[model samples]
Target: MSSKAYRVALSASGAALGAIAAYWALLAARQGHILFDTRKLPVVALSGDFSTYSHTVPGGMVRGYVYHPHGEAALQDLFVYFAGRGEDVRATAKALHWLPEGFGFAAVNYRGMADSEGHPSEIASVADAVQLANHLRKAFPHARLHVVGRSLGSGVAIQLVAQQKFSSLQLITPYDSMLEVAKKRFPLVPLSLLLRHQFNSLAHCIGVAAKTQVLLAERDDVVLPERSAKLIAAWPTPVSVRTIAGSDHHSIIGFEETWLLLVDFALTAVLAMPEAV
Candidate 1:
């Protein structure tokens, strides 16, 4: 009825709208897909003898698919992979041809992903990846275990490496930390502090004593390509790296040649397998 009353009503509406915006932002961060723009490859038909194994994690049963061809002695080195957020590990495993119709490769689901249980925290995924890798290593005692993490998953691998030494480390288009990355993307607001998932890959990567390798893409859209290069430069030891010629962040992993380069790195630089076997 009065001009003062009308002003008050407008103020209340603005406050409500701002609250809605804040809530949506919080939901986005919790989803943990800040840079996860790609779809995981389809599940490939297993061309090997290994079977899928499921184990009880704290929250729920986490399943891992093992692909090892029959009678092929497990190479001292095994590749353990952590797929990016919203992506499944099965396809990435098959896409890399890690199973190769004869060798063993293990792909794990961190909590909150398919078949895995519980909410995903940045540290929890890192811990989960390590736990699953160890389980696979013990199951196949002959194999040497290594880790590969892609994008956000790279942070997971880095954390695991900080606690335990892998045969080698491989990171694909990883960020320095989830907090820093969010800050950069949402400079207008304080997203980093609001973000609950703080995967600090840069800090953890430094602690790894194992031979480390990084894959960078020239056109990475998710993470700055320069940052990836910087990470390599910052490593105390000489971390081997290869940049995909024309690939971007999401497409790099699925490329045919990318797999070739990865296989080469894992087998030669990291694994040190004797060619005779």
Candidate 2:
């Protein structure tokens, strides 16, 4: 081939590679935006009084509310809660009524959500959870620590349980990983290569030693039932699975049976390890 012909061929190849690179970059950005919807949801008014809780992370502060049982119960057990992606956790204070007596609740608002600061990413959110869990451990040295995570927060809880010792871990409508969910939603996108926030809870479950309980929605539209089943099967530790009949993703938490299962599991776990409390 002539030199001019060779140069033209090289230029064509460069252009093709450039187009592929640009497409990958765009896909990554789009996936990140959709995965981490940081826009704050409207806070609902909470019915009960709650104490302010804050933890300083690398970039900013993670703040939320702490709820105690009505009377002097000595706060024997503590539940560190991570709410769903769209959840306005300030309202979680009102849900403290569902918890058994002698249990304290700490609901953490993810960074960039509500009054919390910094951008929301899977790494940052998990780091914030670690900081908050560490703080709670020190604050309630005598209390047995338990974790409850719903939806996106379940990913965070899985990571936390892998790192810290929790009396019990409860996951509500969780997925195997954000990447798997993204792949299901946007099949055309190369999620394995372009996805940034792959919150792989299934991988994290391998190291979790807590008494794990998973609550599944019968008709979960957000996290498909198969993904939850995969996570359950992949768990190395024994996990209790409970499906709420006729409940969807958002409405399952509203069911009284949901809270009853959580309360019973936590109580049973705490009671089993009475020395921890």
Candidate 3:
């Protein structure tokens, strides 16, 4: 080959390689922003029956809220919540009245989100969930524990349920895997290779015995209907799937029907279990 022709070809190849490297590096460096979107959130004031709870995690302290309907000693059914991306979980305090009189609720900010400290990642989030579950189990030994996860939280919920048995699980607008979602958006980029916190909820569905309920939004463009359907298909046991009409990813969880379904599902799961001696 001619020297000039070879030099031009080499330059073209070098440019392509440089562009690809920059793309990979950009994604790698900005992963925390893309995944967690950690930011300073408003401080949630403790009031009524709500109280602040803190736990020592890997990097730092994780703070959250706990609602004791009948005080700590009289805890009934406990609903542990994992919130969607950038969702202020303190908002859960407002929905306490929707639950039964005896029900309790608890939610923690993901590491680096809201009041929580430390960096947020899939591994750290799941580890924090395990710690939270153990703490709650010891605190409310008699209360049947149920889980509610929305959007990104669904991945955490699925992984938690797989490791530690929960009475029931309610997943709102969940996706099978974050990796899959990324692939759809960036078909050319090798997300599987670049991504670190790929929350693969579908893979963890094996052996999960929890009674599951999935709420889907009819017009969900974020997680998309197909991704949710894939997760539903992979569930070990039969899943109760409900698609709310005239709703998108964020709004579906706000619907009155959605709350009713969550409450009813929690109650039904507990009722289905044989009486605890």
Candidate 4:
């Protein structure tokens, strides 16, 4: 080949490689932003008595609320929630009123989300969960603790359940891992190389001992149904699975059946627990 032609080809190849490298870097950097919703959620006027709670993490505070049913002197159980990305946990805490008397609900904003400080990542969020769980356990040592997680938060919940002891766990529209979910959406993006937050619930499933229930949205396009199945398949114990008809990823929680299912499963878990010595 002529020297001039060879030089031109070499320069073009270098440019192409550089562009690809830049593209990969951009994807890697965006993984954090994509996995976490750090924006402020719309303020909804909450009803009932909700106590504000906060936990000090490495960088900043994790702010949240705990709501107990009115007229209830003794709490029977507590529901600790890990909300989906961008979900307003205040609204979720309000909905806890659906639980019968003696039931309490608690939830915290992930770091870098809402009023919570620091950045959101798999490791940091999981660590925050551990702190929150310890706090909740210490505060209400007598009450049975149950966990509820939605979408992105499901990963955090799964990891927490793996390390902590919970009476029950409910996961709504969860995935095996963020890496798998991203690959399903962007098949050509090379998420294995570019994605930073791999919330690999499947890997943690072996450690979970809680009575688990998994709810799936029939039309969930965001978290492909198969991804959830992979986590369910990995569970050390049997997991009860249900599909809410006529719902997608975001809409599944809106159904009355969903809440009923969650509450029923929680109660069932409590009933099945051996009486405390």
**TM, every model:** 0.82, 0.86, 0.89, 0.89
**Which of the two, 2 or 4, has more lDDT?**
4
Instruction: Find the number of clashing residue pairs for candidate 2.
Output: 0
Q: Where is model 2 more than 4 Å wrong at Cα?
A: 1-27, 30-33, 71-73
- Candidate 1 clash pair list: 76-144, 78-144
Tell me the tens digit of each residue's lDDT in model 3 across 131-235. Answer: 888888887788888888999999999999989878899999999999998787778888888899999898888858889999999898889889999999988
* Candidate closer to the true structure by TM-score (higher is better), 1 or 2: 2
Clashing pairs in 4: none
Tens digits of per-residue lDDT, candidate 4, 59-98, equal 8788888777563347777788898988778866645656
Point to the candidate with the largest lDDT. 3
TM-score between model 3 and native: 0.89
- Which scores higher on lDDT, 2 or 3? 3
**Which window of ten consecutive residues has the lowest lDDT sum in model 3?**
268-277
lDDT for each of the candidates?
0.70, 0.81, 0.85, 0.83
The true-versus-predicted C-alpha distance at residue 208 of model 4, in Å, is: 1.1
Give the alpha carbon lDDT tens digit for every residue of 1-277 in model 1: 6999999999999999899788767756554533443333444555555578776767687777776655537445567787876777665655645344334567866665655665567766766676787777677776667788888888888878778866777888877777766666677665554667767666776787877888888787668865676667677788887888889887778877776666677677543644321
